[model samples]
Target: MGFDTFGDFPTTALEADQARRDAFVADAGGESIGVDQLHRVLAAKGIAGNVDLVAGDICETVPAWAAANPDVGIVLLHVDVDLYEPSLVVLEHLWPRLVPGGVLVLDDYGRWEGETRAFHEHFGDDPPPVERLPFVDATPVHVFKR
Candidate 1:
């Protein structure tokens, strides 16, 4: 849910976004999509998911969200390390919540210098082995086990 704007949370902008999406849907002339329909479509494609797009800084948002979601298992964490410093803090907050054998996928791992540095620093020596997935060769995504 990396919705628009640079560095700022999109709390103010999301209303407009919702309106835009609604307008787009209206123009498309299709039945409205609800959570169940979304889940059905995702499941048909072999995916099961839920989304909670929190609007706040990583330090403040992640820990609270984790506490609220204690029973959640097998997290497929998607990290957006646009700013490595803050992303590192977010990773720290998320690591413990991740169950054993869960996967953490870091987007832009090999491409962004700040992301690479931040990952190394946060994981340190004896960090979990990172597997670079085959995507765009220039900007490979990396996966690590929890």
Candidate 2:
């Protein structure tokens, strides 16, 4: 499960940072080039076998979308929505739907503005076990376990 935004809808710095982070994660294994590149990354990573990659918003029919494929091993839940209400709603709706030990990567989570602070407020002190990664051109993106 993943969400990608050009950050056009929410014209905030935080939102733009979130979009960059999303691109970073997707490009990490070189999955940004499309399905063929993603397959290559999977092969190079030695991640053979059945895998389901959900690359879209949590607000979209992700539950149903993921359900369409039952053999998914790892569900990488990447969320880049920077709005308070939308981010919270996405987490609330999608968190419960994730399988055990799934990964949730929230992008641009350290922004000082209230819009970006929503990630912390919604997750609080013990949101999940997260690892923060600093980026050169954008805010840090936090990786969490579900």
Candidate 3:
């Protein structure tokens, strides 16, 4: 699942790997897909491909998403603390809703300065131990669980 406020996407100008760069630019002239459209695409692709997209303020949209998905046992929270305030606010509310064993992967927590600061300030020294997730050609990402 993916969530965003602007919902910008690559315009459709299908090409090969290197040639496709232009297809995914600020104004690639590609078409955009909405949540309903994504549902249709995924439904045709496979019945088990259950994905959802929400476009709104993180604070408002995340809670609504949680309510809509009461059966979601584990949420691999991929946080991108674009800034500090709102991200922490969402985490504050979202943390209590997570199941005991569910994981919360901080995507940008250790990489970005502001994000790391927000997380540290919120949890102090009580944040989960950092572990490196498997990586292929790139550097391994640091994952902090709930």
Which lDDT tens digits does candidate 3 get at residues 1-146? 66655344322222232243343443564344566776777788895266666775665777777688767655576675344554566577566666766667676565544455667877786877677776735645666666
Q: Comparing 1 and 3 by lDDT, which wins? A: 1
Highest TM-score against the true fold, candidate: 3
Stretches of candidate 2 above 4 Å error?
A: 1-74, 112-116, 135-138
How far residue 29's Cα lies from its native spot in candidate 2, in Å, is 28
Q: What global local distance difference test value does model 2 have?
A: 0.59
CA shift at 15, candidate 1, in angstroms?
32
What lDDT does candidate 3 reach at residue 128?
Answer: 70
**Residues 37-72, model 1: lDDT tens digits:** 555776787754543345456655666766776776
Give the best candidate by lDDT: 1
Better of 2 and 3 by TM-score: 3
Model 1 alpha-carbon drift over 4 Å, by segment = 1-49, 68-71
Comparing 2 and 3 on lDDT, the stronger one: 3
RMSD of every candidate to native, in Å, equals: 8.9, 7.0, 8.0
**TM-score-best of 1 and 3:** 3
List of clashing residue pairs for candidate 3? 11-30, 12-30
TM-score per candidate, chains pooled = 0.60, 0.49, 0.60
| Global lDDT scores for all candidate models | 0.61, 0.59, 0.59
